[model samples]
Target chain A: MLKINDLHVKLEEEDKQILKGLTLEVPAGEVHAIMGPNGSGKSTLSYVLSGRDGYEVTGGDATLDGASLLEMEPEDRAAAGLFLAFQYPVEIPGVGNMTFLRTAVNAQRKARGEAELSSGDFLKIVRAKAAELQISPEMLKRPVNVGFSGGEKKRNEILQMAMLEPRMCILDETDSGLDVDAMRLVSDGVNALRSPDRSFLVITHYQRLLNHIQPDVVHIMSNGRIIKSGGPELALQVEENGYGDLLAEAG
Target chain B: MSEIAVKTKAQQTPQVTGAPKAVTALDDRLAAMSLPQGGFSAPARAEALSRLRVMGLPGPRDEYWRYTDPRLFNVPGPQPLPFDAKAPESPLFAQRDTLTLVFVDGAFDASSSDELALEGIEITTLAHADAAGDHWAAGLYGALEAAGQQPVKRPFAALNSAAAADGVLIRVTGTPSKPVHVLHRRAADAADAVWHHVIRLEEGAELTFLESGMVGARSNAVIEVDLAQGAKLHHITAKRAIDPKVGLSHLFARVAEGAVLKSFSLAVNGTHMRHEAVIDMAGDDAVAHVAAAVLGDGATGRFHHDDTVFITHGAERGESRQVFKKVLKNGATGVFQGKILVKQGAQKTDGYQISQALLLDEASQFLAKPELEIYADDVKCSHGSTTGAIDEHALFYLRSRGVPMDRAIVFLVLSFLADALEEVEDEGLRAEINERLEEWLTSHA
Candidate 1:
């Protein structure tokens, strides 16, 4: 569903490469996890893949289901079934949670040539999905994450991912600030939306989130490239042994 | 209600008409009209007019007049007011069986107004109310005078009092499910017109008032609203005056106690227009929600200058929320400054204010200031003001999606203004404002 080839991305007007010689592929009907220490460019890959501005594509290509994503806009990427769950979601005041979600979902649906959902139907689905994600009605009424706690924001991100139902999902540190209960609730939300035909690349520094939404393959990323790939056991190994041993081994 | 009296002495001046000198001569002449004598005559009017005259019209020196130049009042043409003409007509609110009060060039139009069939409501032209010994209107008029004991230094309010043909005074003793719509229309020819109105909502009464201004020539106006304890009012003002060379100033307001006052002011077209709305929160648990959207284009300047809310909280537990959004294009300008004053010992007062302006061209400009003055630490108050061009990224995002530059700009502008629009409770009024916004955007595009 998603693929990147020798992608070398850098900040606009800067020579410092943020994603260097990075390559990965998440084929349909499969799940992949990318684990790395801080500054390993995991979030950078997600941002570049999502086509956020200010990040220049220095080299290589990225595609979604065979179509080029690097050439698309951020909203276009979203319309093309690509979702990036941010580590720290942006707070957009004056834009209600329901309003923002509706715009995003409708934008994607409109781009896909599907009939837009009416306000009534949209509300029904949002309520159902929010309930499953444990997002209270009051929370959905607020401005997008305006005063939300860190864990609630993360969970709200998961709720959006579920609402969007993207073809390819990238969770960037989805468990960073979550407590045990919130972590489980967020993981459960993601796991509930998982299916054989849909693919997800959950990016995190810890292995705890992986235990809930187990990935078929785990890739160890360092220095902007994937150095090793292994089964789910590799996540547990990293949790117990830490990335210090992996860096030494990769060297 | 206690009677509030304002004493006055009018300086004698001639009322001149025609030519630039003649214009000032008339301004000075009108400025010279003495206060009308006893028994509801010139003395009462003089008191209010002179008080307004002393403060003088707002000039560039006033901080509030920084962006909107009141000097537009100086014109080299015929004076549009004090003209002899038939009463103006309105078809917008005619379809609904509303208690209609008609005012032409600030003078009450008894022949045009409709008498209400309901009881417990007193609806009459200010002329008739004044003749009927209605002292309530007198007490409320010029009540919010500046310290100089003037009606207001604003030229429009001054003109409204100086040449006010007549005004409509309405009082609701009990809540009226149906509302009274005051349609203040200007004369067709090139004559300056001025109108004044005073509306009062008695204790426990509620009403929704629709007030708007449409002027063919230069016009000035002042309107005041008082909502007694437990009274509620929803006020909507829509101004569409398209003469880029003409100017108008409006000072409209409301006062509430343990009451609610919500207002939405939309300014889409005018040569130069400024509206100052001050809502006084007097009683405990008083609430006020005021929002305004000003869409300006071409050289036809439109100013949604200021929307202010004064929450006394003297009674305790009061709240005020104000939001203002403006879009400036071509050489148009917008200014918004809002302040919330929380009185001492008035605990649990919550106040929030936000104002933003979008400048679309180098010639376009916007000035915004949001302030909070709190005397109690237990209060929650916050205010934010921002002025900037359209978000380049969001513009690019829309354009990259195949939306043309013009359409994308319109979309972003509308989205930027959506917050204020959503605050309007009336769906019809909201739709009208949105349509006006679209019209302005399309013209500029």
Candidate 2:
């Protein structure tokens, strides 16, 4: 479970306020969706939660399982069961996909005081998860995200999530740039990984991904603050009417 | 030509046991042909020898001689090892049924070398080939001597030309069922050494020549390779010199039309090592590739390197690529100069070059210069050079993942050298090079 309290964040260099007086909480065994139009600071919130550098926390704190996540480094946050599926993944040449994934998985495991997996067992787990996600082995052999198409990169991010088995996973614009069929495959992969002890924060600009993911709670954000929250129907309402009404209510 | 000042002290000067007078006369004869008197013919050979005389023996002042000082052999200089020096026991060629040619201290060790049993392949020493009226063997001996009339500052290259008696000549006539392996080594430990090796790949012939300088002896050598029409030659030279005061090495190569020349030089040790390679794309559609990985530690090591590739349109549609990477620690230094020239008539020429260096500490040094001259408008040519320390972010990333500081540095350093090592085609040879790399990192770390 994760809780964010009165979080106020500003741009590091300019000190321009982005997230002001925002508070949210997601308990275990639940799915939450944050929907907002462009420039509403939805993506910024995810980055701040994950402890990415260059984001100043002007006010409150973020906690993971009662532990302060704000005090941890980006990698430390990752080791403490936090994963962020980037909107645009950086391509690192000469670092093979399989090698990167293995390093990340082992790093988290070591941080949790678990023994490292052998090469044979690691290959077995990677192959099974790749097959389920329809990712070819050749993709795993190339450098990390180098020359991968939009949909394939997204699927790879999901594959890493499945391999890591993090406690809280954040998906930012996961459905963008994906064909309808690819969207379904990715949503299916995410749904399969859902469990009682794990939670997901699915943030997107459109309602198309909701058709497959079916989040338990939907929240509308405006200018970095949550303006409305309701059941799954809230997503359908926003999709039919757009964010015009929500913007007015928040203002 | 002035009396070249041998950089080593008088005591360690090269004392040619039987041929001291011959070397002295040769040196004086070269001096008499000085440019002031117009006695020197200014031929490629004359220029090369004069340059060698000037370099004498590399001293410590030359920036390129920093890590590898030739002064340790000061008292005796360099002397050709006895032709009868015992050859070390190596099973490299015995496993593959390859034609083995052995050389000790720059002279052909005929008793230890085996004759070629393969059909249509002629593998013989330069002396034997010349004795059998092999005109090609004599013609290409000093063919690639540095063309410019520049003063010779490298003593080993000059010594190799002056002292080389019998060199190895490998000629692949018809397409071979298996590649011919030529192993030229400097195994003599007591004295300074010189060996000249020449390999020619004739028309439409394909061959792989594996040359390893694994001998820990002090050596000054020249290796010249020529490829005829459509001939393909892959040359891999591993420089693992262990001696503390050995001079540098100079390598020269010439490639013809539709001919493919690929070479990789691995310099892991040696007090002062310099590998200078010049390639000419004489025929249309010719392709040449040069790759090297150099590692230096301890005292200042020098890699006075040069790669000048000329792609002429008369040999239209030619391609040339050069990649060199240097990894230096302690107070060692590296120098890399790469140039690609595309003549005006050479349309559709593809030329690319990249030189990168990674310095491990503040005391270490790295310098890379990449140049490109394009006269043809349609040609695609680009050159890039980068010198920097390791990525702090990546290093931190590895360290936070539980890898200790030393292991993390090794990972990043090896990743930088991986590009050049990939050019090596043989799996076994690659493994050997990697083993040396691992040892170097562990010892230095």
Candidate 3:
């Protein structure tokens, strides 16, 4: 469902390069996890794919269903069924969470030539989905992530992920701030959205999150490129021994 | 207050100098035309005219006119700008039951106004009452405006007091059944409308005054309020001129001992607009709040808005707050000059002032001047002003959620004005104002 052809990116304001010749692919119906240490261009990969500003795609190609994702605007990429669960959700002081969610859901639908949902329809859908994630009505009414806890913010991100229902989802360090219970709840929310037509590319630094979501394939990334790919046992192997041993063995 | 305080306040103010260029400009511009007529208001008009001549119209050289150019109003006559009469939205303050008083091109529209009397409130129009020899509002016709000009010159307000043809004079003896709505509708394209409203609330009485509608192509307005001891008054204005119009307005209020005064204004659009407010806490423990929410989009037409406020704590334990917020984009401009003064012996006085602007683009700008003067040893006063653009990260967050750039901007802009809107005490009125803001943002965005 998602393809990257030796992606090369650098900081737009400086000569420093962040991602160098990184390539990865995630087919439909499969969950892929990219485990990498810090400063390995993991978050940059997600931001680059999502078309965020301040990044120069020096030499690379990222596509969704054979169409170049690099050419689309951020919102257009969203309409084309790409979703990024931000590592740090933004706090929009005066905008209500529900207002943002509804605007997003309807905007995407309209951009895709689908009829917009009525307020009643949207409210009903959001309420049911929010209840499943243990989110209260008051939380939905508050300003977007203004005073949310770490767990609450992550859960809010997952709520957004569930609502957008994008064809390709990129989880950029979604497990960084979650506690054990929050991690379980967030993984459960992601697990419930699993389907044949949907794909998720989970990015994490540790294998703890992998124990919950259980990825179909695991790739170890180092210095902006994936150095190894293996099955679920590789995650357990890294968990038992840190990335230090693995990096040395791979070298 | 019980008459004595009013006399004392009158005795405290110093004299005003003469410099009324606006008066001379008005006279010159209306060489072939007749300015608004006055009868019982003659003495007050004469006093205001002399004071305005000394104050003179604001000029580029004036210290008080540093941020906003008074040249547009100083000209003999501003060019006539057409107003859109077919606006799809309903008039502001129409959602509630109000004692509606309508005016057309500065003249009182008797046919369109409600009855002259409501329970506990006596309403008199300038044409009928000012034409005669005696009236209750005569004592207050230009008294407060005269007091407001001493520290800083307000030439237009004096010009308004000197020449305003028609307006409403309301005296409240008790709590009114419904609020009063002053509705100004435009008739002529070039009507240089000027109006003055004098309100006196009796001791222990209460009233809510709502002002809305388009005054005229070029207009100057003044509303003077006197709140008696223990009385309460709420004043709100929604400037509904969405087109490129030029106007200036002033609100001068005297808050008495134990009395409360709150006022808020929402300015949506105008080519050039200025709003000035002067509040006097004459008695002990008086509380006053003044706030404004303004939006200017220079994409379709030029836009500039200015808010100037002065609050004086003359007595002990007075509390005052000033909150002003503006959202400008596409080369629009906003300006704010606010001051709080705590007099000697006004111990434990509390004053707060905050002015902020959200600029959607680099071309837009906001200018602010916040001041504080204190002679009291024990007082709490704070003032702040900030100017910033839309958060790029926040914008991306919304857009990444599928909202377009324009829509996302509107969202952030509305959020930015939320602080100013909190000044409105009534929930229903606040919601209606929000609706008006939302519609304006959608079209402008």
Candidate 4:
């Protein structure tokens, strides 16, 4: 469902290359995790795929279901079934969380030439989904991520992913600021959305998140390139030892 | 003593022989226009006229009028424009429960207005009240406007007081069950209209006053409010005008002990528009809040909007807040001048003022002057002003969620004005005003 080839990215303001000759693909019905040490361009890969600004894509071709994702605007990419769960969800001071979600959902529907969801129907589905994530109605009414705790922001991101239901989901360090309980809850939410046609690119530095939501494939990323590919056991091996051995092997 | 020395010094310094040409020209224009006649209090009219003569119309050089030129308003005759008699898509404050008063070309339209009386409240047109003589409204006609003419001069308000042809007088004896709405509809595009409204909330009484619609091509309006001890009043106004219209409104309010006054104004469009407010806290523990949300977009790149506010705490334990927000696009200009003053005996006073603007493009501009004067040592006061473009990160966040770029911009612009909109006390009114804001955004964005 997602494909990348020889991707090279650098900071637009400075001549600093973050992603160099990186290539990875997540097939339909499969979940993949990318584990790397600090400054391995793990986050940069996700941002580039999601069409964030301030990144100069000097070389690369990223496609979603045979559509050139690199040439599309951010919203068009989103409409093409791409979703990014931000590592640090932005704190929008005055846009209500519910309003943001509804606008997003309806905007995508309209772009795809589908009828807009009625407010009544929207409310019913949102309430049910919010209950599953332990998000109170009050939190839904408050501004998006403003004054929200770290766990709540993460959960909100998960809720957005569930609402958008994108075909290709990129989880950028979703486990960084979460506690054990929160990580478990978030993992459960993601695991419930698993389907035959959906794919996830889970990026993290630790293997603890994979324990809850098992990955079909694990890739060791270093120096902006995936060095090794293995089964789920690879995550456990890294957690038990560390990235030091993997770095030496990749070198 | 020193007083005699100062008098001698003033006498020695040769005073200017005559007023500036702009002042004299404005005075000549005022002299040419006939003052409103009939049952108006003679002394009040005389005093207001005298004050207008002395102050004249403010010029670009005036300290308070530095950002907003008063030239457009000083014209001798109304500049004619093609009038669109068709009412707005949705007339504001049109509901069954509210008492609706209509003004056509600055004159009361009794045929279109609702009943003149309501339970617990008394209402009468200024023309009728002035003709009746010795009415309760006589005491308040221009009293608040006269009292507000201190520390700063509002020549336009004085001119409005002296020249307004007709308006309404409202007196609330007790809590009113419904609000009073004044709706202005212009049929003559080139008509110049001036109106003065006086409202008195009796002790412990409560009322809501709502004003909407554009008055005329060249319009000036003054609203005077006197809140007795423990009384409460809520005032909301919305002004939406197309190009080639010049509008000015002044609100003067005095809050007594334990009284509360909350006023909000929303300006959506205009060639040139200015709204000024002056509030005085006369008794201890009084509270006052004044807020405005303005949006200006000139298709021809010639729109201007100004919101000037002055608040004074004259008694102990008083509180005042001023919030002004503006969104300007397409080479439009927005201005805000706000001041907070705490008197010597007004200890424990709390004052807060904030003015912000969102410039949609490089050509759009925002000018703000915020001032605070405190004679009391034990008071809490703060003022802030900011001008910037929309948050790029927030814009991206919304766009990444599949919202179109234009829609995302509207969301952020509306969010910028939400803080000022929150000052509206009524949820229903706030929602209506927000809908109007959304409509404005849809057209401009």
Query: DockQ, in order, for the candidates?
Result: 0.12, 0.14, 0.68, 0.66
Tens digits of per-residue lDDT, candidate 2, B284-376, equal 888888888877775543332322233233357888888888887776666665667777788888887777777787776665555677787
Cand. 2 TM to true fold? 0.76
Q: TM-score for all predictions?
A: 0.77, 0.76, 0.91, 0.95
Please provide, for model 1 over A9-35, each residue's C-alpha lDDT reduced to its tens digit, 9 standing for 90 to 100.
888977788888998999886779999
Residue B314 in model 2: shift from native, Å?
A: 6.2
Better of 2 and 3 by lDDT: 3
Better of 2 and 4 by lDDT: 4
Of 2 and 3, the candidate ranking higher by TM-score: 3
Q: Is candidate 2 or 3 superior in DockQ? A: 3
Fnat (0 to 1) per candidate: 0.04, 0.07, 0.77, 0.62
How far does residue A227 in candidate 3 sit from its true spot (Å)? 2.4
True-contact fraction in model 2 equals 0.07
**Candidate 4 per-residue lDDT over residues B300-342, each given as its tens digit:** 6478898889999999999899989999888888888888999
Best by DockQ: 3
Q: In model 1 chain A, which range of ten residues has the least summed lDDT?
A: A88-97
Off by over 4 Å in 4: B1-20, B87-89
Q: What digit string (tens of lDDT, one per residue) describes model 1 on residues B15-52?
A: 43324554454466465433223334244566666654
